[model samples]
Target: MRMRHVWMTAGTLFAGLGGHLQASDWNMPVGVTDVSREVYSLHMTIFWICVIIGVVVFGAMFYSLFRYRHSQGAKAAKFHEHTTVEVIWTALPLLILVGMAVPATATLKKMYDASDADLDVMVTGQQWRWHYSYLGEDVDFTSNLATPREQISGESEKGENYLLEVDEPLVLPVGKKVRLLLTADDVIHSWWVPELAVKQDAVPGFVNENWVRINEPGIYRGQCAELCGKDHGFMPVVVEAVEQEQFDTWLAERKAAAAQEAQGVDREWTMDELMERGEQVYGSICASCHQADGSGLPPAFPALAGNQALLDEPERHLDTVVNGVSGTAMPAFRTTLNPVEIAAVITYERNAWGNETGEVTQPADIADMLSE
Candidate 1:
């Protein structure tokens, strides 16, 4: 009995972790899209079907138990087989399943039809962050957790959206069909937004497509549905839908900024600039594993504060960053990061967290190496 109780407790905790339920929130969200509504409709339909089945089956079962109780001197009516009863039960269930499958299949077909989209965006999942790149628009940026370390560590009060907040929210135009191409770098990740009814796996080397057409313009939050790594719970997805004009304006600004950053590749960067840029990059891209202070969660993620191998072998460090070590957690950043960001982060790592090597790897040098 004690062991059974322990198993039940464990099962409940695991179910909660799987995002199936909370004390207050048990039902699936009725999202802000047409397909979302269809999904909700289907969910409720199946749910009520199950409920009715349980009621009828249990009602008959308890009725039999009470009505034909041996304690009440009720004799067992021995019956071999009833073809009519068997046929009715089987036919009813088959009909119910066919009824359920029709709507589910229709919803799935609609969800998969990501054709003739107004915009196309590539969503790449990194260790614990999301990178959004607009196809042909030349607008892309990494979105990281915006919650402060103090809040995570219990040093300060947690905000309302603590883990749900991100440094950048994916902006889409309301009433416009935005097609999302999902893929991951290291492991399998699921891009899930409850309100949008978008939960798709980002399998490495495989691009899974899904689309969303938001009926309302508002902010929607979600998290990595897959258990990618240790910081899986911290990976939040925030999408902000706005007017078409507003999205266009945002895209223009992003494109202009991209152009300016692209031009920075030829210029010589000072230590201050590199360090500043590197800190931000590291905090978003590398800090999840290496930590905020360079003191990594070792064995899996070694400490970089005074690592002799990294300090002594600059060429090896650059190679390791650009071309990741095979059969390890490190991913090649050649495609993930641009030349400028690569140089800035490398230079910053050499100098930050009491590991003052005074090494300044310029953007030009990094670009040249990348070309080679």
Candidate 2:
């Protein structure tokens, strides 16, 4: 009865461990793209090969241990060397490795073939956002984290998408070869989307190439797989794969919107219009480093809520916004933002959060500064 109890306890312990192991099983995700699926297949093939090797080796070991035991009255056979066993062991492992390398080489060849891509999109990684430019399409935009501050700060319950959502997703057409020309504005950031089996490093001053062809239409989410800065984790990548017709429609709409915004550069924007637009631009671009209320995370992101220097010197403020502070996280808005957007955000910063400068910077003022 005591022996039975001991065995039962041992079995229970092992069973619990097995359950935990099962719960934490390492299963490679089978992605929606052909290359992703192929990668997964290769992974499984290698995994199973190792598993089979382990089973055969360990099986023989345990069988020899039990069968050749002294308790079984077995006699030991002594030998100096066995050439057949040695040769078999070496040759077998070499053949197995060669077999594994062949398929792996072919897969790599397929992955690197980015020629004859149907579309080209320039992906520029910034501090905590992604800037996408549709080459030859006259469409460009910056995608920011759309998740609210309240949810991130635990003031409210998390949403279904949570940190995975972005203001604008990288839209692509299904079954089309889309080549990405990746680069970074500041530091190194890796643009990775697992479902597409595309992970390329965006190094500053160097452009890396990667391509993907999606088989299915769906929303795929990924994050910056590089340590960039303070808000590295906040930079998420979202891709929306749709049919060719839908993608074309989206492209056209985006181009039209871009044209309208370009026209706004010549017009004089009112205080109310600038304020409203500035609020939106600030929330998306600036709020990640600076707090939502403009009470920035100090020592890194200085507070704009009651910044006396910013309010007193308007020219200095405009210069700072257009040509960013060197050796710091503040990015220049000259290239990333249009004249209107830069003007509005600056005007908003001066007036909002109880500073109440009541200053309205027109787009023409920004255009003049940029031209200078």
Candidate 3:
């Protein structure tokens, strides 16, 4: 009973500090960030220190008020100042601040040093999605929210990680520094993680870099914090930090896959083969915006079916796909997608939805694109 009372007292005192502190103490899972854990510790430390100071100062103030009350017929003595008392009060807080600065400075230094990274990734924030490019590697793809529209509108039960699941996660090797270079394709987006304690802005035309190294392998989730657009809440960040060996194997496979795709340029593909392959590529790459049926979301992603641009000139369509229009939202596929995937998607678009110009884009055409 005595121990219980002691615990209750401590709990009550802790409860007065902050609501967020309770979240950490309760082991409630939030963002996967080490910095958040550090911040929580700092918060609790400062909170307790403030509590102790408050109790001491306020206790003295209240004691003096009760002991020297006028109703008790005590006469008040008038004094101008207490220089010694003022010095002690001012100096004590200054000393306490210096003590707090030590941990804070260390954390700040860690946050700033986004250098000597094992892997470098460029994160480009679009209106409602994130595009990740593995620096110096052939792996690059857009990661959009995978949650269904019905669930977002409360029409259906939300999944376990609704609005948090992405088409592709930013994969990394655990225990290595993963430096992220951020920039925006459209509006401003802030990438934030509560656990790693990293938040950096993705601004237009400007690159911002931040780094993180996980101590353990786990799925870390974050979100686009800035008010980007209508689908801002939908754009979530998911990082899968895996063992170093697994990550290496994944990279090796990706490189081998790229090489295999490069070999496809020399081969002759029939229209039927290209069309079938194109459909699969189209579904993954173009379906997000242009939609599955090729109807396309009007006023934004224009329809490809019977459109003058696609139906009238097959060569122009090839040019546009290979070399995306500048000053527009459409990004060039020359670097992101391999020759086979780009050719497949382009061929699929031209032939699908009755836009049949009976045209097929070969991998060689895309290979020649790099020159232009």
Tell me how candidate 2 scores on lDDT. 0.90
Cα lDDT, all candidates: 0.91, 0.90, 0.80
Q: Give one digit per residue, the lDDT tens place, for model 3 in 223-334.
A: 9989986568878998888899999998888778767777888798888888888887676566666777798878777788778867887777777777777776555666
Q: Write the per-residue lDDT of candidate 2 for residues 215-321, one digit (tens) a residue.
A: 99999999999999888888899999999999999999999998998899898788999999999999999888888899998898999998999989988888888
Pairs of residues clashing in candidate 3: 32-195, 33-195, 33-196, 34-195, 34-196
Candidate whose TM-score is highest = 1
TM-scores for every predicted model: 0.91, 0.89, 0.75
Ranking by lDDT: 1, 2, 3
Per model, state how many residue pairs clash. Answer: 0, 0, 5
**Model 2's TM-score against the true structure:** 0.89
Residue 363 of model 1: what lDDT?
92
Task: Pick out the ten consecutive residues of candidate 3 with the lowest summed lDDT.
Answer: 24-33
How well is each residue in 226-267 modelled by candidate 1, as lDDT tens digits? 999898998899999999999989989989988998899999
For model 1, name the residue pairs that clash. none
